[model samples]
Target: MICAPPEKIFRATRNRPALARERARLARAALADCRLCAHDCGVNRLAGETGLCHAGAEARFFSAQVEVSDELELMPTFSVALSGCDLRCDFCITGKESWNARAGLGFDSFQMAERAKLALQNGARTIMVLGGEPTIHLPSALEFVSLLPASAKLIWKTNAHGRTQARELLDGMFDVWLADFKFGNDACAQRLAKVSDYVRVVQENLLWADTHSELIVRHLLMPGHVECCWRPVAAWLAANLPGVKVNLRAGFWPAWHARRHGEFKNSLSVSENQFAFGLATELGLNLIP
Candidate 1:
């Protein structure tokens, strides 16, 4: 028999008290050796120490509440963007304000809480916490979400690297998990994202997601890197995590840091055939493009 869809199962999550308690517990943990995200910097952030992501005890970033309609599966989502990212995807298109952690600003936890409440008041039931990497500033992110009224839904956009430690921050509270499978090869991952162990981290996280929450994996098909980068990862997920939905994106503009980098300077997004043959035919999985 097939496992129920994460959305269907998650809709039944109503243990508000337990979720609240877990959130607080994670908040306290963040003050210690902050293993919030994969970086596991172990710095005493509560003392206002900055980690590699440059996020201190107080979270800093830019945000706007927008109703996401492009993602049909996650349609009508109210999203809050947290600035800063741990990995540097050379082909990133949204690097306008998030490219550099130094560029973002700080907001008090109370003020951030107010912004979340405002989003909810404006009919945003699902709070999509996106960032350079939400896991990097997880404590503040988790605390903010925990303080929200019990009626709000929590969502995240991540690179899926810090599964073992990151799962503790989650504690089965979030309703949705949107992750990116950047490169299939470790060499490519290290060259592109600067993380050599990305494959293992992403795989482990997806395994955890299979048991805990709804996971949607997105892959941007870069022209010269489709088969070598995106294909094997798709194959692995299809075989290991059969039920998770995969979004095969095709439009990868070599903007942002991509243009400056020779590897991506002239790279075109995946074409229709590449999506059909390379990703679709090989994986037999759902295609979002």
Candidate 2:
């Protein structure tokens, strides 16, 4: 099936200056006791305190480029790789660069807006905010989104473990959500990402995201986790969000500190990929090729 061209939601709200101001105000408030992600660090970012994500009041990003290797639905996209993350995934490809929020070149909302303009000129229809996790800097992200041109569709690529209150505050800003449903169970989550209640938090956020935006759930097929992670995630998606699209990714490779973990030390095998694909098909999931 041919996917439709990206639709811009910000156009309708562009005329409403008050709405934009209100959103900015609320986003700034969230920084007082940063409950942006599931970590709920509650650090006063405005007062120069850093949270678990290590992000401060200002927004920082490592790179901005036109990427063609994303999902087909969001191809020819302009991606902004933000700094800092709530989760410390053992296999993080970005390495320590993403972990240190202050390492990247800092950009205020105006600078990001200027970058978006250049991306749009280069024929990018989608503008994706990625990270360590973009939601960690909610106020800056929202401010940048507000400054963006209405021609490009906004896509937020996240860990899907953000606080519900933060998600509510960002209600009408995004057009699509590219979420990582990394682990299906809590034990793996705590062991891998150092987060508790992963399943519940991700599920609640996914349910909320599906209602507000076009949702695409991605699952990395990890070794020795087909039954524990893949099957359970597929079953849950089939039962609760049957219409949401799934991307059963087989691109896991030993990166960062993954070598220390026995399970994530190697790349996903062909057989493991096949099993995950077969499971998703059996569950009647709408998959993205």
Evaluated against the true structure, the overall lDDT of model 1 is 0.69
Give a tens-digit lDDT track for model 1, residues 138-232.
66666666666666667778888764666765756687788888888888887766676788878888778767777788877776776687778
TM-score, cand. 1: 0.85
Q: Of the candidates shown, which would achieve the greatest TM-score relative to the real structure?
A: 2
Quote each prediction's TM-score. 0.85, 0.92
* Per-prediction tally of clashes: 2, 0
Per-residue lDDT of candidate 2, residues 84-135 (tens digit): 8888888888968677888688867787778887888878888888898988
User: Whole-model Cα lDDT per candidate?
Assistant: 0.69, 0.83
Off by over 4 Å in 2: 1-18
